[model samples]
Target: MIFFYTARAKFNNENGADILAWTNYIEWSKLTQLTELVSIDTSINEVLVETDRTSEEDWKEIVIDGYHETGFYRTLDHVLKKKILKDLIS
Candidate 1:
């Protein structure tokens, strides 16, 4: 089975067909925050992603375990990179 998730920060276009970014540092439900971002950059952001479903669960574990080391997304700077910048307040 293949699963897809839209992350908060990414390099995507106006349609948001392609999205890529740092996903090793966030929660699952947090993906919703990227919607507005997808709309703003609906013109010039394209990202390529490579995935391995076999490790998806392990990936989640790693992210959770490493949270304390990197901390959480507390600043707008953390989530504003590509079109997603529009979704942020800062």
Candidate 2:
């Protein structure tokens, strides 16, 4: 059972003022609705997605199917990793 978190933004104004209010996840098979799938190479354990945001322009490609994504997507994973590591090394 795979899951992915999706950030939801709440707008305070019509002029684009908004805040990331929360996130949610769904099964991997259901991710198609949110993003456009580019390619999936099982041999290399790689899956790529087309950029849906202008901020992602610099990244020629993005791997959406991962336990920890490489960029902003890993924010929560990074925090969790720090906490787990602290406990283990303490």
Candidate 3:
């Protein structure tokens, strides 16, 4: 099993205003969600959604299907990796 930390912001405003609170691994959608966020940043290579606010914090364990990704390499051997094979070729 593989587990990656995902952090989401709870803002006082709807548009992420004031970062009211932070949450870790709210769901298993990072396979589809993280890719979008990471690709938006040019200098970033990977999208790290954390369970905590600190950059060094870690999260729970999960079997990540790295396949359903968009703008990066999919090297994981798990089921999630299959999602990116199609996107990778293009």
Please report the candidate that would top lDDT against the real structure.
Answer: 2
Q: Output the lDDT of residue 42, model 2.
A: 30
Candidate 3 at residue 25, lDDT?
Answer: 26
Per-residue CA lDDT of model 3 for 1-90, tens digit only, reads 633332222222234432222122223334433312323342322233312224221112232356432332222332233334434755
Q: How accurate is candidate 2 locally (lDDT)?
A: 0.33
Q: Please list the residue runs of candidate 1 whose C-alpha ends up more than 4 Å from where it truly belongs after superposition.
A: 1-44, 57-90
Give all candidates' CA lDDT scores: 0.32, 0.33, 0.30
Error of 2 at 28 (Å): 48
TM-score (all chains, Cα) for each model: 0.16, 0.19, 0.18
By lDDT, the candidates rank as 2, 1, 3
**How would you encode candidate 2's per-residue C-alpha lDDT over 1-90 as one tens digit per residue?**
644322222222232422221112224345525322222233212222222446443233333546544423334453344445555777
Q: Compose the digit string of candidate 1's lDDT tens values, residues 1-90.
A: 532232333432334344343232123437645543432232423322212237543244222234341212223332233225434534
Cα shift from native, residue 79, model 3 (Å): 22
How badly does each model clash, as a count of residue pairs?
5, 0, 15
Q: Please list the residue runs of candidate 2 whose C-alpha ends up more than 4 Å from where it truly belongs after superposition.
A: 1-74
